[model samples]
Target: MALLGYARVSTSHQKLTAQISELKSSGVREDRIFTDMMSGATDEREGLQRLLARAEQEDIILCTKMDRLGRNTSDMIKIVDTCYKKGIAIRFLENGLSTEGTMGKMVIQILAAVAEAERERILERTNEGRVVAMAAGVKFGRKPHQGSGMALELIHLDTPIKLVMEKTGISRATYFRLKNHQRRS
Candidate 1:
C-alpha cells in the first residue's frame, strides 16, 4: 500500500501551497497527493474520490486537519470509519495524531464533535440571517432585474435579447426574465 496525501481548500481562489508543502514534508510524494479545491461539505471532489478509490489497507491518508476533510461530524466519522474498516489510516498534521493509535482515535472523535457543533451554529446563524433578510425584503443570491449596466441600456434601447446576452454575459434565461420584468414594471 502507498502513502496517500489529501489536501483541500474551501474555494477556487485559494492555493494549496501550504498543504502541499506540509504533506510533502511528512514524506508523502507529490504523485501520491490528492487535492480538493472545493468546500468540505461537497463530497464530489476529484482528488478526494481518487484517494478513496486508490487507497488500500496499510495506506496512509494524510490531511491538514479534520475539518479540511469534512465539516459535519457524522460525515467525517463516516468517511473515517470507511477508511478505518478498509485498513486505511489517517494522519492529521496540525493535530499530530494518527488513526493507528487509541489517543488518535479519541482526538479524532473530539475534533469531529466540535466540527459538528460548529456546523450547527453556522446553520442556525444562516437561518436567522435568512429570516431577517426576508422580513426586510432583502433577497439573497442572484435577483431578477439585476442586469449589468450595458444590458440595462440595451434593454431600454429595445435591443434583441441575444445581443444583450452577448454584451452582458447573462444567460438566456436571465436575459428574457429580466426583459419581461422590466416591461411589466
Candidate 2:
C-alpha cells in the first residue's frame, strides 16, 4: 500500500520543483516520486512507464493536477480505469480529487469529459485559424533551403552529384530532381 507520486512538465525549460515540493509535502518520499520533463501528448515517458510498471494493488498514485497524468481525456480515463481494476487509486492534489470510490470515479469521469471538450474546442479554433491563414495565402511548413541556389549553380557547372550534395547538404534524390529540372529549363 505504498503512496507514489508522479510529476511532469511539458518541456525541459519548465521546472519540476513545485510539483516535487507539493508531493513531498503530501508525505510522498523523494524516492517514491517519479518525474518526466516531456510533453503529455505521448505516453512514452520513462518515469511514467516506471511508475506504472511498479504499481501494485492498493497503491495510491498522486499528482499535482490531472493534466500531469495526461492531456488526452480518453487516455487519462483508460489509465484511471486500469488502475481502478488493479485496486490502485489516483489522487490529484490541486483538484482535491481522488479515485477511491464510486463518487470519486464519477467525478473523474466528469472531469475527463470536460477536459476532452476543452481539447476539442482548442483544436477547432486552431483549425479555423489555419483555414484563415491559408485563405490569406500564408505558407506553412519548411521554407525553401537557402543552399538550393548554390546547389543548382554547382549542378549547372557540371559538378559531380555527390560533391553538390555534400556542399549544399541536399539529399541525393533532391539533387537529381533539381538537376533534371535544370536540364528541362
Candidate 3:
C-alpha cells in the first residue's frame, strides 16, 4: 500500500524538476520516486524497471501524465496491464485518473489510443515539413562546423592534421567525421 511516483522527460535537455515537484507536492515521498530522461521511442528505462520491481500488490503507481509512461496505445496498455495483474494501480495526477476500478480501466484504454494517434500525427506532419523544406534547399540539423572547409583545405596543402585542427579550432572528432565523409564521397 505504497505510492510510487514516476517522472520522465523525452530528452536529456529536458528537466525532471517540474514532474518531481508535482509528485513531491502530491505527498509522494522523494525516496519513492523514479525518474528517467529518455524518449518514448526508447524502451529501456532503468528507473521504471526498478520502480515496477519494487511495487507490490495494492501499491499505487503515480505519474504526472499518461504519455509519460509511453506514447503508443499498445505500450501504455501493456504497462497498465502489467500493473493490474500484479494488483498494482496506476494514477495519473494531471488527468486525475486511477486504474483501481472499472471506469478508470476504460478511460485508460481511450487515453492511450488518443495519445498514440496524436504522436503519429505529429511525426507525419514533421516529415512532411522536412520534405517541403528540403525541396526549398533548406538545411536541417547542426550547421556544418565553420572551420571544416579550412581544415580540409589545409589538409590538402599537406599541413599536419594537428596543426590544421589548432589553426581552425576544429575538434578531432569533427575532423575525423569530415574525413570519413570525404572518404564516403
TM-score of each: 0.68, 0.69, 0.79
TM-score of 3: 0.79
Superposition error at 55 for model 2 (Å): 2.3
* TM-score top scorer: 3
TM-score preference between candidates 1 and 2, better one: 2
lDDT by residue for model 3 over 139-183, one digit each (tens)?
A: 989998899999888866778878988999999898888777766
TM-score of 1: 0.68
Top model number, lDDT: 2
Evaluated against the true structure, the overall lDDT of model 3 is 0.88
Across 66-122, the per-residue lDDT of candidate 1 in tens digits comes to 888887777687788888889899989897878876666667877888878887899
- Which residue ranges in model 1 land beyond 4 Å of their true spot? 129-179, 182-185
Cα lDDT of model 2 by residue, 1-185, tens digit? 99999999999999999999999999999999999999887677899989988899999999999989888877787888888988999999998999999789879978978987898899999999999999999999977676789999999999998899889999888898888899999
